[model samples]
Target: MYGLEQYLLSMIYHYRYWGLFTVLSFGMIGVPVPDEFIMAFSGFQTSIGHMNFVKTLFFASLGSFVGMNLSYWIGRSLGIPFLHRIAPFLHMNENKIRRAEGWFQRFGDRLIVIGYFFPGFRHFVAYFSGMSELNYARYTILSGIGALLWSTTFITLGNLLGTHWQGIIALLHRYLSRGGIILALFVGIIYLYTSNRNKAKTHEE
Candidate 1:
């Protein structure tokens, strides 16, 4: 396990931006690569002048966008059967899948915007969004925002921490879930407020 991680790190060191992109894209597809660690490492690279911050963030976001959309389309086209067959291979558990579905039920489409902060949640949420037949354009917009927010949060941390990033990485992962929940609820509240206001306006007219 450690060897694979070291190899991935070496890849990032040698190949720079593309390596980071490839890792994040496959990680989104449930490839077992360490997505957050690599992203933070990429940020560290930027600090050392091995990579450009803008380019790294752009590619990381783009990779996640591509991989997630692929998952969405796969779930939409093949439905549950493909996920059932591949779930074992991909290590996707029922509890996690069910949890994601429940969040979708409770939060509606807002989960897609902040799901990226919760590690594997983003993967399953994308599939649920497609299976639930959420509009593609809407999904894309939320996923894009998620990908950007996720990239910026971790990569910036990595860049800022420099040598100490590894120590705080685990803490970030631990706390990020709570932060995501708060943000999701905040967005949900705003959405509800706006929707109610619009309805009231229409009724008044």
Candidate 2:
């Protein structure tokens, strides 16, 4: 097994619930944890009667919520300077941040809830929300909603898929990765088109 996977598996093997929480919490703070795989694995544990699904969901949700808060506070405190230094580690860059900002401006706070399914997007939007000074109460409410939904969906999926969970999840991960890339390209195209059109109108005027 890969070192990262080994570490993740070791954590759960030794500590169970706490391990789940820790991995997910670190993940939201920009650690490269395959959180869905872990959560689903936990769900598979439930199938084998090794873990309780409700408790698993609870721990996972709590961890995700806590991590989201941590990400927000980091952005709130350090702002753009922190992101500049750490963005590379988190697989982010100026263009992604700009796109996130554009989405935030166009969609408002709802993106915080909707972004959970979009992998790296949720992380960026959380940080952006912090930098933008979104109200803490609203961010928490939305974050909680997102955390619960994300946890429940994946964990439950793991339970239902049983032994085949890993294969399907790996496939799903590939699709989500491709979808994220395609979505980025699509958005970039639209942004360029709009900017060029606006410039044309400005020149005419």
Candidate 3:
């Protein structure tokens, strides 16, 4: 993680706004860069007088918004074909996409917000949002708000924690991993229950 922190610091030190923006833009598009860590580090820089707080916030928010919209556009344009092409890499298949579609119909908006908090999985939210053809206006509104909130929260923490930011990042990563597992299990249980209830209703009818 020290290596990651140094890499991010180097990017910010060398390229300033463009570096941060570029990394986040691509990171959100599924590149392997540490997006949240970079954001938080930018905050840490701000705390140390290396970066302007307002500009860092603006660029981070913009990068996140644009990257997500790009994903959405890709999903809208390519639709299932895109998913089919990339699904293998994502460990997604037709059945999973269909299942996700059902959940999107039921809880799409909330997922957009929740997705921001989940690493790895958040990369797919914009694409799935596009494929699902969620209400465009709402997608924009919700995703925009989510990006702002997500970026701000981490950035502020980085600023507040300063030198201790890395510790928090490590801790947060562990909690997020554990939380993701619990959330997945919960979602699976609900899905099974819903499927069974639907099956029973169909039989009764």
In lDDT terms, which candidate is top?
2
Predicted model with the maximum TM-score:
3
> Candidate 2: lDDT over CA atoms?
0.82
Q: lDDT per residue, candidate 3, 66-88, as tens digits?
A: 88888787778887777678889
Question: For residues 73-160, what per-residue lDDT tens digits would candidate 1 score against the true structure?
Answer: 8778876556567778877677544544444555657778767877666776787777766789988998999899989998999999
How much does each candidate deviate from the true structure in C-alpha RMSD? 7.5, 3.9, 2.7
What TM-score should be assigned to candidate 3?
Answer: 0.86
How far is 157's C-alpha from truth in model 1 (Å)?
Answer: 0.6
Q: After superposition, how far is residue 183 of candidate 2 from its true place, in Å?
A: 3.5
Q: Superposing every Cα of model 2 onto the true structure, what RMSD results?
A: 3.9
What C-alpha lDDT values do all the predictions have? 0.80, 0.82, 0.80
- In model 1, pairs of residues that clash are none
By lDDT, the candidates rank as 2, 3, 1
* TM-score-best of 1 and 3: 3
Candidate 2 segments exceeding 4 Å error: 81-108, 186-205
List residue ranges in candidate 3 displaced over 4 A: 1-5, 81-99
TM-score of each: 0.74, 0.81, 0.86
